[model samples]
Target: MSKHGFFQITQKLFLRDGDKFLVMRDRKSGLGDLPGGRMDEDEFFEDWYLSIKREIREELGANIEIEVNPKPFLIHKHRVNEGNHPCVIIGYHAKLIKGKIEMSDEHDFMEWVDVKKYDPTPLFTEYMLDAVRVYLKEYA
Candidate 1:
C-alpha cells in the first residue's frame, strides 16, 4: 500500500541448506509457506533487502544467521482469500550461514526440503510448488 497503491507486497525466501530449502507450516492454514511476510508501511522507504532481512529475523529468530541473494528469482501475483485481496510476492534465494531453525508462533513446523527430490503436497499451493521448481531451474 505504499506509494504503489492497493496491492500488498510480500517477500519470501527459499532458504537453502545444501540441496534443501526451508519451508514452514502455517499455524492457521496448515499450509507450507516460506520465511517472509508483507513489508511494513515504513519499510517502503528503505531498501527491499532490509525488509526481507527483517522478515527473516522476525520469522526465524533474530540470532539466526543467513545470507540472502539480493536479486529476486521469482515474482508472482495472486489473489488472497477467495480473491478478496490481491498480493504480489517476490521470492529470493538464500543460504543458511549458521544456527538451527527455530519456529515462530505464526508457524508450527519447519523442514528442509530437498529441491531435487521434492514432491508436491496438498499443504503447498501451486505457486509455492512452482516457486520451488523455479528455484531448481535457476538457482539450485
Candidate 2:
C-alpha cells in the first residue's frame, strides 16, 4: 500500500534577538519543534494559517500573526511523532505581534533560543534541525 501522506502544517515562530529565531519545545516529545499541526481536510492555506495561529495561541497564550509561505524554510519536512502518523512540519519566519508566553500542556516549556545554539538531540530529529541549518545558511 502506498503511504498515506497527511497535509502537515507548522508555523515558524521567530523573534530576532539581533539575529536568531524563537524555537519551541514540545512537552510530549521533549524536543524542539515549531508551532504547527495537520490541516483539516480541505482546509485552505489562508484558513490553515488561522488554525495554526489559534493552535499557537492556545498552546503558548500569545497573540501571533502568521503569513503563509512566509519565506519558506528548507524546513518543510516530516518526523515520526506518533508511531502511526508522520509529522509534516513547515517553517516560516514569524514576528511576535503581542503578549508573553506561558506554556500549556503541549510543551514542557518555551524558550527564545538562538539559531546558532541549535543542537540535534535524541528528542528532536536531525532532519528537523537540518532544515534549520539550511534556512540559516540559505537565508543568511
Model 1: per-residue lDDT, tens digit, 25-45?
A: 878767778899888889998
Worst 10 residues of 2 by lDDT: 64-73
lDDT of 2 at 7: 47
Instruction: Please list the C-alpha lDDT of all candidates, in the order they appear.
Output: 0.80, 0.59
Model 2, 26-65: lDDT tens digits are 7767776666555555565465566666666677666544
Global CA lDDT computed for model 1: 0.80
What's the lDDT for residue 63 in model 2? Answer: 50
User: What is every candidate's alpha-carbon RMSD to the true fold?
Assistant: 3.5, 3.4
Off by over 4 Å in 1: 1-5, 81-84
